[model samples]
Target: MRKPWCSTSSLALALVTVIVVGLAGAANAQGAAPAPAGPPPPAPTADEIKKVTEYYLRGKDVGPILMELVVCKKMGKSAENKSICEEKHGDTLKKGDPLIAFTRFFVPKGAKYEDLKVKFLLNGEVRSTSDFTLQESWTGYGNYKQTTASKPGTWEILVLRGETQLATAKVTVVE
Candidate 1:
C-alpha cells in the first residue's frame, strides 16, 4: 500500500500551526489586548490651539506673567525635547473627563519668591484651590479628575500671585 505524501507540505503546515498556537498562548499569558482597528482622532485645530493660550491678565506687566496655557487629555515630549500636548482639547470637554492644564510663565529673575494660587471655578463659585510655587521662567501643570458628582457647566482656572490675579483661562464642560 502507498502512503499519502505527508512530507514537505505537511511539515511546513505543522510548523505554521505550532507557531500560531504558541503566539496565541503567549498573548493570552501576558494579557495583551489587540489594538483598536482604526486611525486615531484628528489633531486639534488652529482655533482650538489659540483658545487655550488666550488668557486675561489682571494687572500691570510683571514677573510670572502667564505666557501660554494648554488644555489637553495627555501631554507628550517632542523630538526637540520640548513638552507638547498629545491630545489638545477644545473649549468643551466631556463632563466626566479629567481636566489637565499646562502653563508657561515668564518669571523675572529678580521676581520675589512666593506661592501662586490656582483656582478652579464653576460658574462664579470657587470649586477648588491649590498653591503652585513660581519657578524662574518655567512650566507647571494641574490636573482635576472628575467624579460622579462632577457637574457640567462653564469652568475657569485663575492663577493668582497673592491678591493680584496673574491670568485666567476658561472652558466649558458638557455631558
Candidate 2:
C-alpha cells in the first residue's frame, strides 16, 4: 500500500501543475495588449501649398535668394562626396525631432552676429526664425548641432545677410 503522506504530496503537485497550465493558457488567450495607435497623418491641401509657395516667391522684403541643403556627420563637417546643401539636407529626419547636426549650411562667408537672419519653413510656410546673435555659431558657418524640434515634411531654410538674402535649402523630413 502507498503511504498516505506520499499520496497527498502527489495530489498537491498535480494540482499545482494544472493550475499553472490553466494560468498559462489564460495568458496565451489574452496575448499581448494591442499596440496604441500612432499620431494622425499631416497632409497639406493643394491650396495651402500653393499659397505658401507663393508667399515665399513673392516676398519682396528679402532680395532674390537661392537655397540648398547640406548633410554631414556629427563632426560639423560635410560628409564625403555628399552635397552640403541641395534638395535633401539629411538622409532622414523624423517628425517632431530636433535638428540633426552637420546637415545645414549657408552662404556669405562668415555671417556677423548682427547681420544674420535665419528662418525655417515647412511646405513653404514659415515655422520659425532666429537671428545671428540669438544662437551660437558653428565655425564661420551657421550652427547645426543645436537641437530644435521640427515638423516632418518638405522643409526649407532661409538665411539672410544684412539686407541681402543669401541662400535657402529644401529637404524632406519623413515621419
TM-score of each candidate structure, all chains considered together: 0.51, 0.38
Give Cα-based local distance difference scores for all models. Answer: 0.57, 0.46
- Candidate 2 lDDT over 107-160, as tens digits, reads 221222455566777788877766644211111122442334466778766667
Runs with alpha carbons beyond 4 Å of true place in candidate 2: 1-91, 100-113, 133-142, 145-149
**Which structure among the candidates has the greatest lDDT?**
1
Each model's number of backbone clashes? 0, 8
Runs in model 1 lying further than 4 Å from the true structure: 1-62, 77-83, 110-112, 138-149
* Candidate 1 lDDT trough over 10 residues, lowest sum: 140-149
Model 2's number of clashes is: 8
Per-residue C-alpha lDDT of model 1 across residues 1-175, encoded as one tens digit per residue: 9986788767755765565466446534443233336998787764653332232112223545666666666655444223445576788887787666566564443344466776778897988877766533212222222222167998887767788886777888988
Cα lDDT for residue 156, model 1?
A: 81
Quote the lDDT for 172 in model 1: 89
